[model samples]
Target: MNQQYEEKLLNLIDRMVETASDDELFAGGYLRGHISLSAANCEMCGKTSVDAMNNAVENSLKETQSELNPADQLIVNAMWEKLRQEAYNK
Candidate 1:
């Protein structure tokens, strides 16, 4: 990944960790790792990591959506939106 993309992904993970609810612990952590690894892998492949990470995270969220309680799912969705927006906010 480019430095800028790596920074943005890390920054997004930080923001998520800061604001995520207690119930989001495992999911958020997994999301962070997913994005980080994807970014690092992209650097080796000479690709844009942001888009790849975004799609992976989005797909992961969709699969995990059923795991959250209804109310928690809403919160997760909102947090995901915020993180997504912040990731590209530079």
Candidate 2:
């Protein structure tokens, strides 16, 4: 993963710290771990595309889906999609 992509993703998460609701805050914190891990994995595997980074994050979340209840899974998934879109738009 490129440093720019990782930075953009982290920036989005950081920007949400002040105004996000409790659920959004939780989702952001949870996603931060997955996003960081995915970026590290992508870098290790020589994957540099945004799509690859997104896929890696999505796969990581899916792999751990059982850890969260359905509502939390929905919140996290929605947050991921929103962040992904915003990052691309920026």
lDDT of 1 at 11: 70
List, in order, the clash count of every candidate structure: 1, 0
- Pairs that clash in candidate 2: none
Candidate 1 lDDT for residue 34: 53
lDDT of 1 at 70: 82
What is residue 32's positional error in candidate 1, in angstroms? 2.5
TM-score of every model? 0.58, 0.96
- On lDDT, the candidate that comes out on top is 2
Expressed as tens digits, the lDDT of each residue in 10-70 for candidate 2 is 8999998999999999999999999999999999999999999999999999999999999
lDDT of model 1 at position 38: 58
Error of 2 at 12 (Å): 0.7
Model 2 TM-score is 0.96
> In lDDT terms, how accurate is model 2?
0.93
Tens-digit per-residue lDDT, 8-72, candidate 1: 75676666576666856655555566566656666667776567766756776777777768887
